[model samples]
Target chain A: AQSVAQPEDQVNVAEGNPLTVKCTYSVSGNPYLFWYVQYPNRGLQFLLKYITGDNLVKGSYGFEAEFNKSQTSFHLKKPSALVSDSALYFCAPPTNTGFQKLVFGTGTRLLVSP
Target chain B: GAGVSQTPSNKVTEKGKYVELRCDPISGHTALYWYRQSLGQGPEFLIYFQGTGAADDSGLPNDRFFAVRPEGSVSTLKIQRTERGDSAVYLCASGSGPSGANVLTFGAGSRLTVL
Candidate 1:
């Protein structure tokens, strides 16, 4: 079974500062990890994904994620945060094990204050 | 082309009423997905369609929830005998290729409220 966990319920950051949203996973084989953002009354927007390759993966909106096999973690990061970046962040384990259905975390609310 | 689209941005119904939510995927995208998001929670997978067939429907809460994609372009999710517990946002997403890449584009979800 593939599953994801985002420990924090909410994370607070300031505009122009660095930001990080953490995630970890549990699966039998290699994992496909993803990061998505959801603003109020909107659908989730894909941020990044790590399937295979280097540990560091860059994605849309200047976002990036680091995959650590030993730690079973894939964390989303950005060098400079924006008030516009404030939203709900979700970490998901790709649904690839026969079913191809993703299992998502509880979501972490990112509040980037200016 | 346009991104994935969903119909009836908001749907309100009584507890026993039935409701159907629709989704139109990208022109050539073959993989489509349906998920449910409750207040303060992340989206939960309900079903996934690979072409015209339902490849997975494991996340569906129960038999009351049904979906179809006969033409492989547009799809509809039907919920019968809705309950208060059914109140949530129904989100639809589409991705390109069979690999189910990380490039899943989502539609503005349909908000369903059961009274």
Candidate 2:
């Protein structure tokens, strides 16, 4: 079985401050982790993915995720949060035992206040 | 099309009605996926297709839910005896290359409302 957990239902950050949305996963073998963002009434947009190699993966909109093997975590981060950065963030791993499909977390709502 | 496209952007129907949703994957994309997203939750995988064949459908909730990609280009998801619980936004996505990379291009989902 493969699954992901996003502990926070919502995360609040001030504009210009760094923000982090936590994610953890359970997988049988090497994991492929991903981050997606969804705005209201819109489909999800791919942010970043961690396949292998470097622990830190940079993505669109000045977002990055750090994959921690020991911790089984891949937390999304941004150095300077903007109000436009506010959206729903999801953590996903390959569905089932393979990499064809994806199983997503419950998602965390990010709010960047000005 | 430019990206994955789903038809019937919004649907409202009563329980027990049959409904069909359609998806048009990106040109040259061999892999397509269907997912359902409930309010306040992330999208849940429903099915995956590698060309015209259904590579995996383990995520489908029940036998009443069926999908086909006969031509390997466009796909349709048919739901029989729709129930209130089936109401959710159905999303479609397309990707290229091997399944390992799993990079998908998504479409604005079709919102289904079952009353």
On residues A46-102, what C-alpha lDDT tens digit does candidate 2 reach at each position? 999999999999999999999999999999999999999999998888865454677
lDDT: which candidate is best? Answer: 2
DockQ of each: 0.63, 0.71
Off by over 4 Å in 2: none
The CAPRI quality class of candidate 2 comes to medium
After aligning candidate 1 to the native by TM-score, how far in Å is the CA of A17 from where it should be? 1.2
Would you list the clashing residue pairs of candidate 2? none
Score candidate 2 by TM-score against the native. 0.95
Q: TM-score each candidate.
A: 0.95, 0.95
The DockQ of predicted model 1 stands at: 0.63
Give the top-scoring candidate (DockQ): 2
Candidate 1 overall lDDT versus native: 0.89
For model 2 chain A, the run of ten residues with the poorest summed lDDT: A94-103
Model 2 residue B11 lDDT score: 94
lDDT of 2 by residue, B8-114 (tens): 99999999999999999999999989999998778888998888898889899999999999999999999999999999999999898447667888899999999
Worst 10 residues of 2 chain B by lDDT: B96-105
